[model samples]
Target: MVMEFPLLEGLSPVERREFIAACTPRRFRRRDIVCHEGDPGDCVHLITGGRLVVRVTTPLGHTATLTILGPGDMFGEQALLSPDARRTATIVAVTDATTLTLNRSQLERLRLQHPQVERFLTTSLAAQVRRLSASVLEALYLPVETRVLRRLAHLARVYADGAGTPALINLTQEDLASMAGTTRATANKVLRELEDQGVVRLSRGAVTVLDPAWLATRAR
Candidate 1:
C-alpha cells in the first residue's frame, strides 16, 4: 500500500521502513462506519486493504456519495492538519478494510522526523479541490446518461481490481445515482439502455461494466 504513495516515494529504504513502523494498523468489518461526519478529527488513516465510500448527508436526509476510495488511498488528512477540525464526511467500509493510522500525537513526531508528510497533505488537498471543481462542471452541463457513464468509467479506472477478478464496480443503482447527481429512476433507465447496448450488466445491488471502451465513448 505504501508503494504508490507519493509521500513515501522519495524515502530511502531504511527511512520508509522506519516511517511505516510508526503507524498503527486498524481494521474494520464490512458495512462498518469507519468515521462519522462532524466527529472530531483525531487520526489520519492510510488505507491498506479493501474499499471505502465517502458519503455526506444534508440536514434533510439527502445523502450523496462524494467518492469511493480503494486500497492505496488515504483519508482524514484534512482533519489531522487543522486544529479543531471535524470530519467533513462520513466514511464507511465497502468491504472488510484495513488502514494504518497516525493520531495527532504521533503526527507531531512525524512532522519533526519526516517533513514529506506535509507535501502529501497539500497535494492531496489540491487534488480533492480539482475533483470537486470538475464535479461542479459536470453537474451544470452534463446530461443524465453522459454523467452516469462517466461516473462508471471513473470508478473502473480508479478502483479496478488489479487481480484477475473482473474490473467491475460493486455499487448499487442508488449509489451510482447519488454519485452521478441523478435520480434513481433516471439512472435505472439509462443503465437499461446501456445494458441493451451491451455496455453494462445490472445485478442485485451492483452494476457490472461489460464494455469499458464503449462506456468511455458515451462519457465523451
Candidate 2:
C-alpha cells in the first residue's frame, strides 16, 4: 500500500522505498481529531487503513461533513506546498485510522532531492483545484435531494467494499443533511421517500442503500 499512492507514481522502486521509510506512522481512535481547522498545515497524510471524516465546524458550531476518506487516499497535501497556510478543514477519525505522516520540513528536503515528487505534487494540486471548482458549482445549482444522493453515490465509490446496493454509510442523518447542505427535517423527508422506494434503509445512525445503481440514476 505504501507504493500505491499517486504522489509516488513517478518514483522508481528504490525511490519509493526511501520515501516510505521517511514517513512516520500515526494512529487514531474513532472520533479523534486528527487535525483541527485553522491549525498550521504542518504535514501531509496518507491513509494506510480505516476511514476519516473531513469536515468544517462554523463559528456557530455547525459541523458540515465535507467528505469521507478511506485507505489509499491522501489529504493535508495543501500544506506541503504552502507550509504557513491555515488548515482548510478539520479531519476526524470516523473509525480507527492509521496514516503515514510526513512533515513539511521532510517534504521540502525531499522536494529538493526528488524533482519527480515536486512535479507530482504540482500536478496533483492542480487537479484538486479543478475538482473543488466543479463541486462548488454543483452545490450551488443541484436540488437538495439530488445533492444528498450525489454525496451518497460518491461516498459509496470511495468507501464501499462490495458491489451494488446496501452500501453501508456510517453517518448520522444529521451528517448527511450537513453534507447535502439542507436542513435535517428535509433530509429526513427525502430519505424516508427513498426508503419507500426501496433505495435506502435507515437505521439508528447508519444508512444502507439498497440500490446504489438505481440511486445513481435518480441522482443524475
Candidate 3:
C-alpha cells in the first residue's frame, strides 16, 4: 500500500520532498517486530499510519514499553548518527502499520546533501535528552499515581480529540504502567479510581479524559 510520508512539521518544502524521496516504504502487521535491542542499527522508521510500541528489555528479560508512537513520530534515529551503533530498544507494531524507512547509508548521504536534515536531527536528539531527563526525575521524585497522571496528560495533549471524550488513540494499561514506571496493577487501580470519580472514561484499551484541567492537577 502506498501512504504519504508525513513531513516533519517545520521543515522547508524542498527538504521535505528530498526526505520523502529517500525513504523506502514498508508495511507491518500487528505485533510485528520492527527491530530488536542490541542489533546493529539499519534504519529509522517514520510511521505513516497505525502505531508502534517502543520497549526496552531489562537485564532480567522483562520488556516494558516506553511509548506508543503513531504518525509524525520517528524512531531508530540514534543508530543513524552513531557508527555501527546497536539499538537500545525494540520497536514492535502495536497495530497494523505502514512506515517510511531510511537506511543508514541513505541517511548519511542525506546529511551531506541536505545540511538542513542534520540540523533537524540534532534538534530531535536534544529533545530526546530532555525527555529522558524528565523521566529519570519522575522516577526519583514522583509517586506512582502522579507519574501515571502525567503520562496521561501527555497523551491527552498530543492525541486526545476533545474535552469529555476518550483519546482517539488506544493504549493498554500494560503500556501505561511501563511508561509510568509502575506495576500494571497499580496503573489499573489508579485508572479505576479516576473513572469512579468521573475524571476520565475507560473502556477496553481506550482512555478518555473528562476533565483535562483536573487531570493536570492530579499529575502534579
Listed in order, each prediction's TM-score against the native is 0.87, 0.87, 0.83
Model 3, 69-183: lDDT tens per residue? Answer: 7777778777777778788888898788888888878877887888778765766678779878988899999888899999888777656543555565478888898899989
* Predicted candidate 1 versus true structure: per-residue lDDT over 38-68, tens digit per residue: 9999887888888899999967898889778
Across 1-220, the per-residue lDDT of candidate 2 in tens digits comes to 7565876777777667767888899999998999889999888898898899989987798778878888878888888777577888999999999999888788777767875667657766876898799789888988888988888877766667755446788888888888888888988999899899888888999888778788778778
- Clashing residue pairs in candidate 2 are 166-209
TM-score of candidate 2 against the unseen true structure: 0.87
By lDDT, the best candidate is 2
Decoy 1 TM-score against native: 0.87
| C-alpha RMSD in Å of predicted model 3 compared with the true structure | 3.5
Q: Which order, best to worst by lDDT?
A: 2, 1, 3
- Model 2, residue 141: distance off in Å is 1.7
Global lDDT of model 3: 0.80
Model 2's alpha-carbon lDDT is 0.82
